[model samples]
Target: MRTAIVVGAGIGGVATALGLGRAGWQVTVLERAPQLGEVGAGISVWPSAVKALQQLGVTGLEKASVVSAPAGMRRPNGQWVVKASALGLELPVMVHRAQLHELITSGFGSGVTVRTGVTVDGFADGAVRAGGEELRADLVVAADGLRSVVRDALYPRYAGPRYSGYAAYRGIADVELEDGGGETWGRGRRFGFARLIDGRYYWYATENRAAGAVGDVWSAFDQWHDPIPELLEATKPEAVLQNDIYDLPLPLVPFAQANVALLGDAAHAMTPNLGRGACTAMEDAAALVRHVTGPAAIPAALTSYDAERRPVATKLVRVSRNVGRVGQLDGRIAAAVRDGLLLTGGKVAGLLARRRSG
Candidate 1:
């Protein structure tokens, strides 16, 4: 059996290991963390990602997820810019990030092994030095996050992740809401809330801020709509997690080199404007497995994976950046123009749908 070593045990790494194991390859996953887990938050698993999970033999997500009500854009004062009914797009199922992590970790069978607390020092000649041992494999899949050591090692000259001029705060509250919840956009800031499967509410806020800046989360959205304040009040101070948003630069470095392949954020980190970051990573896991299965050779499989995933992921990165820039408009005139355009676009779309139906 072909042997593979996967670095990092995030969702993408674990999923890749499962895929390779199912493809008759012996796989070992190395994670630097002492244990495999995720910080608290909720993720929207879109239709495409759901399909990818199925392809990787992961199940039970449907039972564990809350089918989201249609969502729309709103102003800070709770007036709807576009109603949920007007969206006309299939809504994603909301699942807790930790729940999904546990589900994926539990799917590993006999063909795959995961070792945590193993720090990878370096890679050479198809071998990775970790835990004072040299381990070689037929393939090395780098699923390490945004600051991927493997990626840096391969392409030292490539510029890495760049800040998106915004910081994000996320938390889950134990309160329930009647409406599944939606996003509220304001000048240079936004807040969104959604129901979680566990009878809790997941909320996220973003604002233009310097890196490592600290302030009160409540103060940030104190003037927003009703539920926004309520949710913040319900959240414990320590539960709110903050981080600066960052994405890989355009004209991406090749995702694969020789037998080493970069996956997830390591390959194509993007702004979370579309909530497609994790979905795209799941897509990568599926595509990597598909191209690597029945492989003519390891290098050829890596080449095929690169060819199939790079173009799509690169496009999404650019699209997401553009969306972030538009969403973070701070100027009063610019915000007005944006809001008008959104209202107009929604009306036009609604009109087109009505005409087609009639």
Candidate 2:
């Protein structure tokens, strides 16, 4: 039987393991954490990612259309920049990150073996050393994350994660709210929230700041419009999670080196501006299964996977970075210009929508 090793038990890593298992490949998942679980708050699963999740064996993900109501980009004072109905945006499946992780892990079969509390020290020539154990496999997947050990082994000299000059605060507010949440943008900061599948609200705030700076989520968003303050108030202070945003330098390439593949953040970590980070990783896992399940050998299949996914992921990384720059614009004049353009663009889009309907 074909054997594979997945570094990191993140959403991407687990999905890859499950998919490989379904493809009849035995998979060993290594995690430095002592237990298997996911942290963080809500995650937005776009339509494409929903399909990928379904393809990977998650079910009962029906989201009611009622959640897609009147909402749009707004200012700090709650002025609407662009309405959702006008944008005709596709609604994503909002879910708690832990719940989503559980769903994916449930798909794991006997062929998948998860070893937590195991640290992956490094790799060389396609062999991974984890927890003092030198491991070899038919394939090595670097889903480890931004500071991936496997990725360093494959491309030691490549520039890795670059800071986005912003940090994000994420949390789940157990309290109920009546608003159909959307993002509120202010100079150098932004806040967004959405109703999760489990009836709680997931909220996040981004601020332009130096990496590793201490933050007060409440102070950052307290002056914003309704529900922004409320969301933070409802959230436990300790439950608030913050991380400086970073992305791997683009051209996300050579996803496969020899028999090893760089998956998820290890390959294309991007700003959450478009919320495509995890979604794209899920897509990578799906694509891997598609190519590897065929008659082609592992290396050739991974080559096809890299060819198909690299371009798409690269484009997303670039766009997301640009969006982050705009979203986190700290200068008052620049932010005003950005909002004005977005409002004007939204009007034109609305006009086009009406014209097409007429």
lDDT, candidates in the order shown? 0.90, 0.87
- Per-residue lDDT tens digits for candidate 2, residues 207-304, read 88898899888888888999888888889998889999999897675899778888999989999999999999999989887888788998998999
lDDT of 2 at 260: 88
lDDT digits (tens) for residues 214-285 of candidate 1: 857799899898889999989998989999999999999999999899999999999999999988999999
Measured on C-alpha atoms, candidate 1 has an lDDT of 0.90
lDDT of 1 at 338: 99
Clashes of each: 0, 0
Off by over 4 Å in 2: 63-70
Estimate the TM-score of every prediction: 0.97, 0.97
Which lDDT value does model 1 have at 166? 95
Q: Which ten residues in a row have the lowest lDDT in candidate 1?
A: 82-91
